[model samples]
Target chain A: MKSAVKIMFLSALFAMCCFSGNARAYEYQGVDIRGFISQGYLQSTDNNFFAETEDGTSQFNEAGINFSAEVSDRLRLGVQFLSRDLGTIGNNEVILDWAIADYHFRDWLGLTVGNMKFVHGLYNETRDLDMVRTFILMPQSVYIEAWREAISSIQGAGLYGDLGLSDMGSLSYDLQYGTVNLDSDKGAARLLGDQWPFEGMGLLVDVDQINVDYTYAGSIRWITNLEGLILGGSTWGYQFEADATTLLDTTNPMAAAMLQNNPGFVDLVGPLNAYGARFMLSPSEFGVETVSYTASMEFMWRNLVFAAEYMRTTYNIEFRNSPLFTTLEPVLSANGVAVQDGTIEVDQFSSVGYYASLAYRFAPWFELGTYYSVYYPNEDDKDGKERVAKGLDDQDHRGWLKDIALTTRFDVNENWIVKLEAHKMDGSAILLGADNPAPEDPAEDRYEEDWYLFAAKMTFHF
Target chain B: MKLRSIPLIARIVLAGIVLSAFGGFIVPAGHAASEVMVVAHGSVPVESLSRDAVQEIFLGRKTRWSDGQKITLATLKEGEEHEAFLRMYVGKTPHQFKNYWKSQVFTGRGKAPEAFTSPDELAEFVTNTPGAIGYLPQRAYQNQLKSFMIE
Candidate 1:
């Protein structure tokens, strides 16, 4: 309740700030406000096979109201207030989308400060817009939930600019320092209370409080054009993060074992390093006699992008090591294993993925495009960490996961656009927990089959 | 051989008709595919621009002109011939172009060009404003509005 009041007060203050100020009439110094809202109906053949309900269909679906105001030529402020239902679950939240102040010193140098998105690829910064992106599902590797948590946006400052390689090419660079948020924190006290069903007897109210801490990241992008072909390459650098799940109390040994086996659980706290590249070949100027194609391919190398990212989370806890190993085997006793205090530390995790999309303009106002991508995780941990954390079996490669999606858009007119898309996702990581066991099955491989989706959107901007 | 001679007036008329036909065949005027002049302040140093480069600058890809001047692409009112000009030269309708800038504007990715209602106003704005670049009709070229060649 107190938090709600604080949020309201802050919102009011922001509104006043937006409305107040010295009115400037310079050519490049004015405020530009824009927004869009979308509402539609959705029906699902099987709300995904993992869904507990039979046939799933929804009506009166709607998108949150999103708007951005260019406070000045150099600064932008925006937010997304939304209430939407994903399958059966619904959420109402206000996300601070972006607040940035940009300064262009020269054509070759610029700097920005505030909460900003990662410069992972061509679409990473602008992927939120349905109008700009070709696919509804972003390449899953870099944008997967786990990766989103690991490397998406941080509250910090960044430096970005271009270096002229020649008239035809330039190298783009970005460096950022920011803070990451902690999701939740659970302790052994909760587990013991759940197991014994006892209360008032040393019941530790270990509230899972969200934590905000320091984070720094950087990126380098090199783009050049050759014979009408634009080629871009980028590399991402980041600090790691770990999940919030940990056993703080020392009483329960079972909790410690569970934590040891699940050290790789996505820790909301950790350091990360990721990178990727994009190559776009546009044939509009190639003098192609027939249909022209604008083909773009992007590749991302990053850590795991799923709930299992917990195991790879960078925390000070040694959840990966415990007395269970020596207990299981006498020969393992020679390993000199140490009992972990229930924390996980991750040095780094990386994956390689790419999206290949081909768009052909059938007319001046219309175009058709198709794209697909495969994301694979690096299975470096032989301790079955990837399998248990990702819910895959030992047969799973630390780097073996793939997802593909196909999309088509029709520009009905200047003010309206309609898009139809279907996604064929394969892998244990894509599962959003529907038939999967509860969080209790930390090591369970909840691999889902080729789930399909049919969705559409309409947008109007003024 | 048949008549031994022809009337002088008739012969003269025949000769005039033949000469006129020859002249018509020999002299052909070039089609009026006139070049557009991008007018700017004398401070801007540029003589010519490629069609693609012009399109990119006007379309907001290339932010600066060759002379290191920040290129500010402006436009007249909707449905004006300027829309057709942009379409012909930049391969984008004026509405499409504005919306592109609008997206960039609200996103804080780029700056939106100032708009006017008439070529005269645009010319006046461009000529007076530093680092401003605008297009004017060749016929409207005067001492007040200078024109740069855009091939």
Candidate 2:
């Protein structure tokens, strides 16, 4: 698959060069094609820990290459190919990250439909574009392995727009609905010796989620410009999401585990009742002369931003009583515990998280920001211990992480940019449970998860 | 001092010549300080405005006059001196002002002012439209526009 993709890319490039050299093609009026290749190195203070980054601290990192084409004035198409080595562990893979299209209408209304990245906030849309965002790694809480495909991108449709209310203010909104395809099912075998299972495995396949079990989500944002003597702006956004799966297939354990966890699967499959809202205000006055400063304050309340989501997900599990357990209970009465005939398991997951961030911009391309996020998972889950041990209990340790980062961007030229960023991460060890053990006393197991990661990128446009 | 003694009248003449030479340069020639006027097509009353008020008007920070009327602001598309005018009077660069308006455009906060390529075009538009406002070099002054005295 990798070789095929590479061959296709090379042939396409050759054909494009030949066509350009011969026919002298005309530039598409509203269409544009841009591509970039960025590779960087990283050195971290820690290694061999699954904490948050199992990729380990390595000085050798091969970044991804992206190809984006503008379909029209209002629509856009994008493709990203990525390959990376996780330092000394011999783990590397290549995958197609995003293949999507975006649409804009009258600046006030926009829609995106296809397999696309999640637009959680200001960073989501511009995260992959090294030219736009100053950070190398995205905010980690929003990106987790629990639902690997669901966190970064989703396969669905999204809508975004702006609304002017009066002479005083206006609102901006973004809404999306989509599913993540985890696995596909093959009914029969192939003619060649090579089977379907091996063909569908690994980082080579497209974002083709196999199972119907998926995640659904939506977000609404409102921004207002307070036109007064002292100019100020405020924004509020809310996001809600839910996950669903069918666990009957033994071949798919992830799906089975999700179903088993959410016995009330049907009710919690789509649009789980979760929401996040934030209120921020920044004075619009940019002092006299060349240098200026802007300070902002925001308070966020997320019903579920991860870990302890305040929202409750309820599901029902269908089960058939085992004949041996029902009829021959005495025979199964091992070690001292008595066996039950048939048990119907109903599970309710209650989780919530919230945070506050303060950011200051010293210049057009420089900023300092900090955030505090807290979450709590289901305390009553009998499987929390094992899940936490495996770093799957991100939902359990609610108040375990805090992140601070300083970011800067330098526009080298009209079409090129260089960005530098550093991060100070602490707490949230539960989210990194795989790298660390669950604290016996919760407080006594206090482990400082601090690491400094830095990256520089040079981006160019055509 | 005892060896060389000059005539008193000759010394006085020399002192007078030096004073006259100094006086000639002390005052300048063709140095008329020009006065700027706030012009419009229709009725815009002449009112005393502070520099801050004029800065606000030119920067698009203030969109209305004191009498609750819309102000139509105009500008020439290109010129080296026009930028000097903005810098000296409005205290803002054209690029800075353009970016400010772009932000307002994206957030749907305000409408951008119309632009013209030449001063004659600006004058022509201002003459036919009410609440129209524009400025030009003192030499391009005309009677069709009302001169607003910003003193």
For residues A252-298, write the lDDT of model 2, one tens digit per residue: 34333534544453232333222211111110110011111111222
Give the poorly placed runs of model 2, Cα more than 4 Å off. Answer: A7-30, A47-112, A143-148, A183-210, A227-346, A350-399, A408-410, A414-420, A428-462, B1-151
Model 1 gets an lDDT of 0.44
The DockQ for candidate 1, computed on C-alphas, is: 0.04
Residue-wise C-alpha lDDT for candidate 2, range B1-151, written one tens digit per residue: 1102323423433353344335434543222334335567676654455545555566544555666466777766445445555555665444445434433322222334556777778778878877667766655675657765554
Q: Rate the local accuracy (lDDT) of all candidates.
A: 0.44, 0.40
Top model by TM-score, which number? 1
In lDDT terms, which candidate is top?
Answer: 1
DockQ of each: 0.04, 0.02
